[model samples]
Structure formats: C-alpha cells, structure tokens
Target: MNGMSRIVKKVTQLLVSIIFMYGVYIVTHGHLTPGGGFAGGAIIVGAFALIILAYGSDALKLHKEEAGSSASESLSILMVLILAVIGFFVGGMVFFNNYLPTGVVGELISAGTVPLYNIFIGMEVAAALLTIFIALVIFKEESK
Candidate 1:
C-alpha cells in the first residue's frame, strides 16, 4: 500500500539480485578493470535504493538496516586502517605497502593487497552511503 505499483515491485524483485551481483563483480574485478570500489559501492547502494523505492520504507526493517550499515562502515574502515598499519611492520616499513605475494599479470589474484583494499573500501563506501540514506529517510519521516 505504501509502495509503488505491483508491477514495479515485481520488476524490482527480479532485478535486485542481478544489480547486486553486478556491483560485486565490479568490486572484485576492480583491479583488472576501470571500475573500482567507489563505483561499485555506488552501484550496490543503487540496488538497495531501488528496492526501498519499490517496496517503501515500511516494508523493510529500517532500524536494523541503519544499525547494520553503521556497524559495517565502522568495521570496514577499521580493517582498512589495520591493513595500512600492518605494512609498517611487515614489508617496506611504509604505510599501505603491499605485503602479500603478487601473482601472474592479468590474473584474478595478481594484485596482492590491492584487492583486499578494494573490498574493504567497497564495503565502507556502501555502508556509509546506506547509513546516509537511512538517516535521510528517518529525517523525512520525522519532519512529516
């Protein structure tokens, strides 16, 4: 009742998984391709936004989403920072140094620590954006 038409909701249900998967692909293959963590994160959030728009805020557990996204954002940023700090003690004694072994060029695992960074960055960006969106939704409801 609060959301859009049934057709739109159905379409969203069908497309959400595909969109989410595409975003994950972009994040994972970022080092090999042009799209990276930031782009992928935006795409991932777009999927969630589409769902919310199609189903309305009442259909989803908004408070849980807010809490989860906030926690995810915090944890991901902490992991990223930890990875950076580890470089000082591990490889080159410099921040963000790649300590992991590199693989063959053009391979999926060739980027060493770069992929890890991308994954965490994608998580952080997605969670942060989701949290912002949730806050905006809450504010809008409160204002009304």
Candidate 2:
C-alpha cells in the first residue's frame, strides 16, 4: 500500500541479492579490478535504496536499519584504525605498511592486508551510505 506496483516490488526483491553479491565481489577483487571499496559500497547501497523505493521505508524497518548501519560503520572504522596501528607497529612505525605476505601476482589472496583494508572500507562505506539514506527518508517523512 505504501510502495510501488507488485511487479516492481517483485523485481526489486529479485535484484537486491544480486546487486549485493556483485558489490561484495567488487570489493573483494578490488586489487585485481578497477572497482574498490567506495564503488562497491555505493553499489550495495543502491540495492538498499531500491528496496526502500519499491517497498517503502517501513518495509525495510528504517530505524532498525539505521541503528545497525551506524553500529557497523563505527565498528568497521575502528577495525580499520586498529589495522593501521598494527601495521605501524609491525613495520617500524610506518603507517599502513603492508606487513602481510603477498602470495602471487594475480591470485585472490595475493594482496595480503590490502584486501582486508578493502573489505573493512567497503563495510564502512556501505553502512555510512545506508545510514544517510535512512536519515534522509526519516527527515522527508517528518517534514511532510
């Protein structure tokens, strides 16, 4: 009653998972590919936005999602900071010094700590974006 047509809702439901997976793939293979945390996170948030647009904010539980996304953003940033500090300590006070071993040239696990950074950054970006979207939705509703 609060959203689009049934066909739109069904299509959104089907595409959301695929979009999320593609985003994850982009983030994971960022070192090897062009897409990275920021791009992938934006892609993931597109799925969230699509769901809200197709099914309404209530269907997505905006408040709960906002809280969860905020928490995830915080946790991910903290983790990134911790990783940077650890890198600094382990690499003779050099910040973000890739201390982990680089396996192969074109392999999945070749980049070592870079992949971890990408993952954490992806989480942070995605959560931040979702939180922003939720806040915008709530603000729009309140203003009306």
Q: After superposition, how far is residue 118 of candidate 2 from its true place, in Å?
A: 0.3
Q: Give Cα-based local distance difference scores for all models.
A: 0.93, 0.92
List the RMSD of every prediction in angstroms: 0.8, 0.9
Give the clashing residue pairs of candidate 1, or none.
Answer: none
Best-fitting candidate, measured by TM-score? 1
lDDT of 1 at 60: 69
lDDT (tens digit, per residue) of candidate 1 on 1-144: 779999998999899999999999999999999998999999999899998899888776888889999999999999999999998799776989999999998999887999999999999999999889989989999999
As a whole number from 0 to 100, the lDDT of residue 126 in candidate 2 is: 95
Each prediction's total of clashing residue pairs, residues at least 3 apart in sequence or on different chains, is: 0, 0
Task: Report the number of the highest-lDDT candidate.
Answer: 1
lDDT of 2 by residue, 53-142 (tens): 998888877778888999999999999999999999997879998999999889999887999999999999999999988998899889
Query: What TM-score, computed on C-alpha atoms, does each candidate reach?
Result: 0.97, 0.96
Clash pairs, candidate 2, are none
The segments of candidate 1 whose C-alpha lies over 4 angstroms from its true place after superposition are: none
Error of 1 at 8 (Å): 0.4
